[model samples]
Target: MAAGGRGSGRPAKKKSPTKGTGGNKRRGLEGRGATPPAHLRHWHKDKARTERVEREERTGGKTSAARPQTRTRRSEDAPEYIGGRNPVLEALRAGVPAAAMYVALRIDNDDRVKEAVRLAAERGIALLEVGREKLDRLTEGGIHQGVALQIPAYEYAHPDDLVSIAQEAGEVPLIVALDSVTDPRNLGAIARSATAFGAHGLLVPSRRSAGVTGGAWKTSAGTLATLTVARASNLTSALREYREAGLFVVGLDGEGSVDLEKANLLDGPLVIVVGSEGKGLSRLVAESCDLVVRIPMHAAAESLNAGVAAGIALYEVARHRRR
Candidate 1:
């Protein structure tokens, strides 16, 4: 008879109704009787739906088709391109892999563009017809010459690779480096000489240096295709790496202690650093050299162009190494 007897326990509690039903079937909750406020429930669902739509948009949802494309909208995995007919042609001849090529539709069977298209076809590189505006944007103000090649950026060889390339050819390694060489023509000419002389390779800085462009390729007469040219983040760092790899660093300066021909370049591995035509090597680059050698000249010339200086120095090194 006690009130606490098991049989007398209070009747099972009725299931609680979910809150905020408000006589609306669509807004009803299961039987917890704890529904949120009506306004809050509507707001929560709307907010979640908005977030889901926003996420889809950010991820390039189906609705992205209506968005206008941007000029700078490059493909996510498109290879870097180097434009101009000569560069493209040279790249093709050199057996470089081109991911794709773009020809100006306006060109309409131009011989040069046609040749580029043929080359791309032969190499199995895809060819696309793009508007001139796209070509201009792709080249970034470069001389596209009605041809743009989507080849990967130049793959530079390590300075030490010079040694093996030379030794394997049964010759001493003769490498060239440029200090603040600004003229693409000079860079190209140096490449030409380096290739012609059977020198090992050439190295230049990644910044403040002229790249292998159309003008430079023409200057090289396509010799760049055969030569192994390496680019360094900086000349000093490249020189240091060269020195560490058992190569002597020789710098060219007009007012140096030793003559160019007298330098002992043939004794071992050598890398010659030639400065810019106007402003010779920077103070740091000059100090990094093991020795500063000068090319003897009469008072007739104030200085030599960087290309000429590099050619002269490389010739001497090659000649000495041969002897």
Candidate 2:
């Protein structure tokens, strides 16, 4: 009989054992630690939704919410669709660059709708007729009033480019910088005032600040089209850069030592930083300013709106420049 042959009647010689798997079998028996939380489990069906809710809660709604199951969130640079008849009509009148217009089929025609359609046609904007459900979805359930207009994202100029713009125009640069202002309407109003008062452009922090939106466009009364808005990654750094460029960084603070009228810095290349309505200038932003000036107010008045404050400051600056 052969040694180690199968079904051998004689006892076979014992074979030497092979190398072990180094505890792999034991590790596999242990399982993958304890199961992670539902929100952290990638394979869980509700993991994404649980994570989104938790994130929103953690951020106190500062972060944008997860997109609806019906639609994905639009990119930052994507065109915005403003709903409501008045907004649509006004956007068209303001010459907001439009890619297309969406009108609900069988909508009750009103004067605003008629005018919007006419303006869109005149401007060569594509008119898309969609069902009410689709229009609602597109507008994100906003009060669309059966109409929506898709406008291109506002093109922002560079902070340095604004200085160059003023230099090219042979004018002392007067730039408006927003510290923490988050309201698009306030931005629009400030832009209107800036344009009226001869500001070169607007500066806003890229985060925690408002950008050009439909609300801003409507509030500006089309003035935004004429004025350039620039985004700064860091408002303080941008202010420092302006200072190095031979520009005065003036911040509007209620506790400012110098009065707006008394501050002689507005006559030169200047950047006026207006803080949020509730909170004046942030500490870093206030410190970055070459001077902090306050608008004169009656003792009875607690605080002024950011838009109004900026308007007054800009007007005073414009007055100084004129003289």
Candidate 3:
């Protein structure tokens, strides 16, 4: 209105002078130019995700993407056989302790097969040359790829022992319990996160839970060796046992009455129960919780994966305890 008259309809804005004015008006798309459109903000590719997809494609979807198949039925034995060259090679690469490597007689040498034999001999694992017929039976007639590796069974500790060990160490017990989380990678990630957040150990139900497998070991990136994982016959019963031991049992639910941020009981003995991604905490386990906590999210209907949920809860507990 000051520059023009009141009735003028021109946009009321000042224009910068040309070059040689107070400022160099060399603004002809200078200095990073304009930011791309909002849709272009995500123009940068996610390298990790791209690589994973590429590997999965190269392996015919048989990379870690098929890790659940690794959890597929295996012989119930102290030392179990993992068939397929890729699985065996992958397991060895992940540093899963193996007792021996079985090679089908006159197996053609490939990169992984050669590597497996080399690693077996290097790591002092007995190399057994067996007929394909035996390996066929050992792998339950599944594709063995002329190779198999024997991994020792996972040693599960008693749930009570987790708390007792923490007590003996003079530290408040912090444990994580998993219900119906079937992904071994998720299990391994939880182990890594639990260890990072000072969790004393982890627990999973005896049935319908991911056990420590080669994929899990790889996913943990070696934290699985340091974290004690226990298998509970019944999760509800385990909660009751923890409650009787004078520990607070908190369940992570999306619609619980208590807010995780406001629950300050973490300074004492505690166990956080994380449920499956799709179903959440089971009804019986939810009933056993001393308090059910729902973490505040950035948006409604948004949730974290089981491993991430467990990690965040553990981090919150550790934060409050530190405070």
Clash totals, every prediction:
3, 1, 0
Our tally of clashes for model 1 stands at 3
lDDT of 3 by residue, 261-305 (tens): 899687889999999896888899899989888988888657789
**Model 1, span 1-323: residue lDDT tens:** 66655588766456787787566775454466777886779888899887665444233233344655453233323345567776777767766666788888767575666677787898789888877877786666677877777654456786567778987998766788888888878988898888877777888787888766544655675677678887777778878877887788889998788998888754577788889886788899998899899889999999999988888877777677667
Q: Please state the error at residue 301 of candidate 3 in Å.
A: 4.6
Where model 1 places Cα greater than 4 Å from the true spot, the runs are: 1-80, 108-112, 182-185, 205-225, 231-241, 297-300
| 317 Cα displacement, candidate 2 (Å) | 1.2
Q: Provide the lDDT at 56 for model 3.
A: 41
lDDT, each prediction: 0.74, 0.85, 0.80
TM of each candidate vs. truth? 0.64, 0.73, 0.62
Candidate 2, 20: how far from true, in Å? Answer: 65
TM-score of 1: 0.64
**Candidate 3 off by > 4 Å:** 1-73, 78-96, 101-123, 127-149
Note each model's CA RMSD in angstroms: 13.8, 13.5, 23.9
In the range 116-139, model 2's lDDT, one tens digit per residue, is: 999999999999998888677656
lDDT of 3: 0.80
Highest-scoring model, TM-score: 2
